[model samples]
Target: MPLRSVIKTQNNQRRSFGRDRSGATAVEFAMVAAPLFMLIFAIVETFVISAAGILLDTAVDDVAREVFTGQIQQADIKEAVFREKICGKVDFLLTCDKLKLDLRTIPAFADIPTDVPMKLKRVDDSSFCFDPGAANAITVLRAYYEWPWTASFLHKLAADTDGNSVMFSIAAFMNEPFGDRLNSNANCS
Candidate 1:
């Protein structure tokens, strides 16, 4: 073929290929992929928050067992010690420094205070309250963690005045007989 004819044929083929609709699906997918991926990631993040909640509850229960059985008291546990133990077991994604705790030992379940003090309420990054009470005492343990909120609705449900979502766990039980039982007042501060 002549050089001029070859060039004309090549240009025509290039124009046809450019007009071809075969790649339209790919273009459409590229356009839609972003929102789809975002939705998927949002779902995964939601599941993660839920799993973290369950894991937080589990960790609290595990630590509260020691407190209920007087093991924590026998070892002379402090607030920092309790926080360290729980934060170590809970989600590493969470900021451990913002973790807050409130523990009070009531004399009897009937004597348990009506007020549920520790909640995902106001933003208080103060110290943890450590009061396991005397032996055989009814211990009320409340743990609060200010979880980072990605979804706005989560903040609406569990978030404090701040934007962070709050996670709470409560456990109450009497101490075991492994330690010496002593009489202590309820409503520990």
Candidate 2:
């Protein structure tokens, strides 16, 4: 072909290509798919984590009420039983094995510890203990769980070495004077 005709043909093809809108929507959607999916996953994961935390807090509050009312006495329920009860109540998104419980009596309400543990794995850790105090005594109950991140890209959200974040709930109250004050040596598992 002649040079002028070849150049004109090339320009026509370029214009045709530029004007074609056939797959434009698909291309635009493809470009945004990854980021859109990531945002959705982040929102969903945050919601589920928040819900699990709320469930855990509700369970702790309910169980602590039992202790406050002398329904969960050292003489009646074992530590394992108490733990099972809490786990049962939080069965929606949390596993029982990952749950940790610490129930103990404080010298006074003002003596309640204000620190959260830097490392937590099991209920047997030094930071965890089981001791239901006597009637009218001040007590604090705490629960913890390690929430694993499902998305690899969200690893930065994890706070623990195992690539998971910690969820915790606490309840503090003075036990209602119901049971014998002497029956306070409760063991927690």
Candidate 3:
């Protein structure tokens, strides 16, 4: 073959190889980067949600402790006790009126009523009599918190997919911290 023809064939081969390699970097990038991005985003979202849940749980336990110890009175039900103790302590996580605290004294596990009121009342004042044998009676404090999602995208996802409200309930139980001691004659209705 002539030298000119040989050189032209070599140049043609090089041009074909260059065209084939053109998109190789982009394919490699797509393969590696897609899953890595997803994994990173998932981890960040999980951490945010878990932190919010822990904060809400802590707030519930705090409020329940106060209710069981008789530190909160009927007058202080929603406004004073809940506002100051629970909602105030949680940083922008919960609101006072948005929370519902229900304290029930269960004389017997069977006596625990299903229709529990959504208020904090003195268990002693209720017509429900306390049984001494049931001193191990259960005091159920239910804390309902409406947790707003920190991420707008997550909020929309929850609403659209699960139809679950942004609210969650955390219940803390302690044996009636006070068996039968009625501290104040003040009506805890």
Candidate 4:
């Protein structure tokens, strides 16, 4: 072929390739698929975690009212009863065995400890406490739960060594002076 003819053929092929739209949609989707999926998963993870936290907070508040009014303290087994009450409220989305509770008397509102760590991978008796305190005493109740993530990439959000994120809820209030909390009938209803 002559050189001029060869050059014209190459130009025509280039124009045809540029005008082809058959694979454009596939290419565009491929380019955006990864980041798009990641964003969607992140949003879902955030929503689920937020919802779980809210549930935990509400459960803690509701159950803590029992202690504030001296109902829990009147129970024969204060710790066990308190745990069961809290678990009943939050068991829909969270495992009951994985729940941890800490209830103790605080000298004053300012004395409430804020530095409690969540690094414990396994929830156990040593991981928390239960001290409902006497009537008219100030107390703080805290609950901790380790929530597992469906997406492995979300492990980085975990505070526990087991690669699960921690959810926390707290309630602090004074006992209502219900009178003779310990000697009263077990009215932990």
Q: Candidate 2: where is the Cα deviation over 4 Å?
A: 1-22, 120-124, 159-161, 181-185
Task: Give lDDT tens digits, candidate 2, residues 53-127.
Answer: 999999999999988988887457667888988999998789998897889888878888765676453223466
Best candidate (score: TM-score): 2
Steric clashes per prediction? 0, 0, 0, 0
Instruction: Give a tens-digit lDDT track for model 1, residues 1-189.
Output: 999999999999999988998998789999999878767876887888788788888988999898877777777755677778888997475567776777777667887544434435564534345687777677878777667767655556553446665677778888776667432322244
Better-scoring candidate (TM-score), 2 or 3: 2
Error of 4 at 76 (Å): 3.4
TM-scores for all predictions: 0.69, 0.79, 0.51, 0.77
Lowest summed lDDT across 10 adjacent residues in model 2 is found at 118-127
lDDT of 1: 0.72
Model 3 TM-score is: 0.51
**Model 4 ranges with Cα > 4 A deviation:** 1-21, 118-127, 157-162, 183-189
Worst lDDT run of 10 residues, candidate 1, spans: 180-189
Worst 10 residues of 4 by lDDT: 180-189
lDDT of 3 by residue, 1-189 (tens): 999999999999999987885788889999999777866776786676567668877877776666555555322344344546666766574456655555555555666444533223211223332111122345655554544544455556656323223434445454454445442422224
> Number of the top candidate by lDDT?
2
TM-score of 1: 0.69
